[model samples]
Structure formats: C-alpha cells, structure tokens
Target: MELRPWALLLSLLLLPSLALAAGKCERLVITGSPDAPPLLWRDPQDPTHLIGATADVLQQVAKDLGVKIDLLYGGTRSLALDEVRSGRMDILADAPLNLGELDNLDYIHPALVQTDYLVWTRKDSTLAYATAGDLQGLKGAVSERARLTPAFDTFATQHLNLQRLPTLTPVFQKLLLGEVDYVLAGRYSGMALAQTLGMSNDLIAHDTPIDQPGLYLAISHNSACNDPWLRGQLAKKMTELAGSGVAQAALQRNLERWKAQLQQPVGTQTK
Candidate 1:
C-alpha cells in the first residue's frame, strides 16, 4: 500500500511533464516576405529578420502559447514558401491559402487577417474603377510574388493587361510615370509605401478591393514541430486575436512604424 501511494504520486508528477513535452514545442522558426509592410517587412537594422503586424501577431501568439519564435527573412516570398515547404523552416508567418500549398502545409483556420488588395493609380488619373472588369485591357502591374485571388488571377490572365513586377515600389513608380495604368497592391501596405516614398499625394488606392485574401499562419508538414496540439493551440489563439482586434491594431501601429523608419536618413534600407 505504501509503495502504491508513492507510485501514484510519481505518476501524477510525470504525466504533466510528459504531456507538456508531447504537446508543446519549445521553439518554432518562421519566415515571410521582406517587402510586405504593415503585414511584414525586413527589419532595417537586422536584414535577417522580419517585422510588422503579422510578425507582432505571431509573437503575441507565441507569448500566449509559451513558445519562442524566430521570424527570419528567407529571401523572396517564393523562396520563403520554398523554405517552409522544404521543412527547413517550421512556420510561415504570413501565408495565403492556395490549393497547391495544401499538400505541403497545414494552414491555421479563421485566418490571421484578410488583406485587401486595391487598384492603385495616380491621383490625377481618370480611372473609373468599380470592378475587375473595369480594368480590362488597362495596363496594370503587381508583384510577381503576389497572390491576389484565384478568380482574379484567372481573369487577369485571360482579360487584363497585367505585368508582373519584382516589387511594389517599382510598380507604383511605373504608375506615377504612366508606364502602367494602375497597380494592384495591399491597402495598408500600399499606403505605407506611398507615404514612405513621399508619393502619397500622387497615388491613390481604390475603395473597392480587387481581392481580399485571408492571410494565414501555416506550418510545414515536414517540421518537427508539426503536431495536432500546436496547430490547435495556434488556431485557438488566432480566433481569439482576430475577434479582439489585436491584428488590426497591430496593422495600424506598424503602418506608422514603417513610415517612421523610412523617414530616418540612414533607415532608407530595405531587403
């Protein structure tokens, strides 16, 4: 009887620790686009890392989950996706839901946020923009890495005159110089970049969103940390954060942060 009591006590102690070890990962490595601002962008001082609203949201989730996360710059968006796909990185901080990626990653449901991609044009342009159809035959530019929407992608490929550029800045610059009729870009990111380039007065994002794709936190299928427990916890926390307006607040806060960083003379660097 005495041994049984001692054994029960030992079992109680070991159970919790075993469960914790099984259910939780100590650290997760995450990566995302370096040029996506308000959502995420390269840290000027540390080119290896990324910072912005999505990064902040992930950090907050990590805090709540009691895990350490590293948000690194893994080259271009495609390269970042490749890193996660290769399982070299554990998580992708900002991922768009795509049927192709479903094979490689498990995307957390309820999405972190829906990014509104807007049609941007020179403020003086007489572009009557109400629908994607209005942009038919019009010259447009978007980042080569952008995932607007499946339907929009199909429509653009067949009907729209869209050029895939390497980055957003040059796309907007092309709009200013009249090389392109308009550019498709994220609302807040476009605003932040335009203000940073001092082109806020010259550029305008249409109220109608061309595409509003949900940005998700996706875990690589190949990651050592890829488990049901971590995915469930992240999904639960994301649901809470989405309803609490933390993501939106982070977006607004980082929008200003990006602009402020660019205002510095030595801070004009970006990856």
Candidate 2:
C-alpha cells in the first residue's frame, strides 16, 4: 500500500483536535443567584445548596457529558460572580451576558433562558407603560444587581429616574409605599417572590416588557475545567437543550414548582 504525504500532514493536523475532544474535566463547581427562582434559588430549608430549573437542567447536562457538577450557594450575586471569576468556582449558571465578563469567561451561546424584564406597578397606579419614554417622569426602582441589555442600560441611565434596591422584594415594597412609582424585574421571578411575600395580588406587571435578555452558563477561563473539549461539549448540549424546547419546559415546570413551594405553610415548604 502506498501512503500519500498529504494524508500524513492531514492526520498530524487533526491530532490536536482529537486530543481536545477527548480531554475531560472530572468535576465542575458552580454557583448562581441564591434567590432567583424558577431558574435557580437557594433551597429555603437547605441554604447550603441550590435547586430549580437551572440546577435540574445542569444535572441532566452533567449526565450526558459524564461530568460531575457541584452546584452550591456561594452567597450573594456579587460574591458568586467573584468566586467564579477567580476560578474558585468553575461555572456561573444563569449568568447574564455582559462585556465585563467576556474577558474572564467563555459564555455558552443561545443562552439557557432569556428573561422578560417587566415594568411592575401597584395595581391601582395609573402609569401607562407602552414604552421607555412613558417611564421618564416616574421615579422607579430596579433590583440593584439586575443585568439588562446594554441598550436599556444606556436608555435608563440617560432618561429614567431610577434607584437600585438590594432585590425585587424591596423594590416592590418601595413601589407599594409610593417611594417609587414603578419597579422593574423579570416577570415570572417577580411573581414568585411576590407570592412568597404575600403581595402577588397587590402588584401588576405592565403588559409590555421592558427588556428581554438572555441568561447563560459561563465557564471561567481561569478554571482547570475550562478546556476546549469541555467548553465545546457544553455549548453543543446547551444549544440542543434550547432547540429541543427542553429548557423552556423545565422553566415552565419550575415556575409551577416554585409557586407551589412558596404557597405552602412554613412547616411544609421543604422536605
């Protein structure tokens, strides 16, 4: 048998790709929002762990990829971002797409979810919210840590009179007290927290959403697990999950699960 020189060259060129595809990281440690439910939240009964759609979906991804995931509560959003950014945590699930993080993380594209940031007002308020301009004169509050589209960020900064509260609970509280005319947050997430705080009936989300931004899983470039093989596989799987409608279904299911859990008596909320 005669072998061509081009065949040898091609085989050598393909070797690195093959090796990369074969490389696997044994464990991936992840952290995310401690209180953002439907997508993720700290288990009320077990503060040490996180549970919800993001957790459940990642568990499935781990099974498919044959990797281990350690999803734990790493504290507040800033603290969780710090841990993953520093490489102490391997991944940040439900991470918002931001320019700052691009330097330190490899973002999985097409995102696991895209959230609708709604304009929430007291049910009795007369704020007519059809667009961003309608919010100009109104004093508003947004969750201090909320991440929004760059366009909205710019628009709000330039035109909207808004303050940042620690979280949605207080933002809504302020709205009800008239400290702010409106509060902005993800529609479903705001609803979950509203139900938990027993204020679901008191607030109304404007029919129009303020912004819809994609939320992703970001792997730290500083992590030992952030190799090309793992990143590629993770991205591939995420795209599949998104395309198959699995991610949306998980979100829908968890929305109901979160409401049910939040609605339960204190003694029965957890198992």
Candidate 3:
C-alpha cells in the first residue's frame, strides 16, 4: 500500500521534532565565586579566566560527558546562589548545601565532602580564642549570606560582634590590618588566599573548625538540563572520582603546589 502524501509530509515534519527531542547537546551554565580558591577563583594573569579545583572537576566531567560548559564568574556566594535559583545558571559548583525550603533545586546524593570554617588572624597579633564563644565582645568577620551551622550561628549571635563581608579576600585583609580581630573562613580558602596574597605566614589559621557541612553541585529546578540521567551521570562521575581517590589526589597536589607557590608568592595585588 502506498502512503498518503499528507501522511508522508507529517512524518517528515515530526521526524525533526523527534530528533530534536533526543540526545540534544546539553549546555550548562555554572556559577562560582572568585573568593573560594583552590575551589573556584579568577585567574590572576587574566581577569576573565577562572581556575581551581571545582573548575577542574567540572572540566573533567564535561570531558567525560562530552558536553560544553559556560563559566560565569560570580563575585559573591549570594549572587551565585541567586543565579542558580533564578535559572540563569544551570549549576552552582562548590556551593554549600543550604537552600532552606527551596525545593526548586535538587542536590546530588552524598555531597562531595564537608568543608569547615576556621578562624584566621595575623601571626603578630597575640589575640587568641579557643572557640566561637571566646570571641564575645571581639569583632569577627564572616562571608556575607554564608549559612553557618546552627551552633556557629548561635555563637555568632550571642557572643561575637559579627561583620559580614561579600568575599573572603577583604575579610582576610581586614584581619591583617586589625580592622577585625578575626575572620571566619574556610580553612582551604583561607590558606589559599593567604598564600596568593603573600600573607601565608602573616595569617595563622586556627586548629579548630567552627562549622562543617557537605558541599554539593546544585542544579536549578527550572533548568532544561535537569533530568535523572544527567543527575545519575554526574553522581556516578563524582563517586568514581571519590572512590578512585582522584578528587583527593587532585586536591592535595593542587594544595601543595599552591602552598609551594605561596612560599615564593605571586598576585599579592588584591582586587
């Protein structure tokens, strides 16, 4: 039997739609902060360039998945979170999992790992604090909009005179200049920034961690790329990286290299 002309035309038109619906190129926009270095940070030599651990991991994932990534430089954590929530960004890399009641976003299972906050101060300063409570009456700085664990938040509220800053660099600078007695910062970030700013020895990171939480790759609910297959792929890749020790090895090597460079120092100029 011969097919009708109308039916043949319809089939041809629907063929494109079917193809379009299947295996289309997955494009994703990821937002990251320049302050969270060795995790995410702007390249010093080139202001437009972004580089770090999260960046590296995402790059690897993109390679493995055979997809392209568009990187957007987000200056603040709040701005980054907003971009992701608003669907302006497909993913927010290295973001602390804290979307209180916002179900529009879904996080991958078993976060990459936990990150903790450290109290950093200049070495010359004799001031010391055993815990967040010890800072009562002293001025302290924390990342703006940073979701401190309940315990830390309570301590900050009850004891310390907390000052919120948009980014970690300024907070560290303030601590160096005695603008703030101490700055609550991510231990890795604090160390990286200190080295980058030629203040590694100048800034002393305390042994105690104030707060720790799992970090995740947050996907926007409205993102077109959000789907189970994509999520599974990402989770699997993360698991492989973790189980194979690829992530930890990369982190340690990068940290040591960063520390070594800090010994020599570069990019002391701040933005």
Best by lDDT: 1
Better of 1 and 3 by TM-score: 1
Give lDDT tens digits, candidate 3, residues 1-271: 8989999999999998777755654787888775565676666555565666777777888889988987677656677777788888788876666658258677876566566688888888777778666777888898774556766677677777999888767888888888998888877767777777778878888888878766788888978788788888888887777666666555666677566545654455334
Q: Locate the minimum summed-lDDT window of 10 residues in model 3.
A: 262-271
Q: How high is the CA lDDT of each candidate model?
A: 0.88, 0.87, 0.74
Model 1 lDDT per residue over 180-262, tens place: 99999988988988897889998888998989888888999999899888989988998887789898899999998988887
Model 1 ranges off by over 4 Å: 1-24, 267-271
Using lDDT, rank the candidates from best to worst.
Answer: 1, 2, 3
Which ranges in model 2 have alpha carbons more than 4 Å from their true place?
A: 1-23, 267-271
Q: Best-fitting candidate, measured by TM-score?
A: 1
TM-score of each: 0.86, 0.85, 0.73
Encode model 2's per-residue lDDT on 155-225: one tens digit a residue.
Answer: 99999999987777788888888899999999778878888788888989986888999889999988988
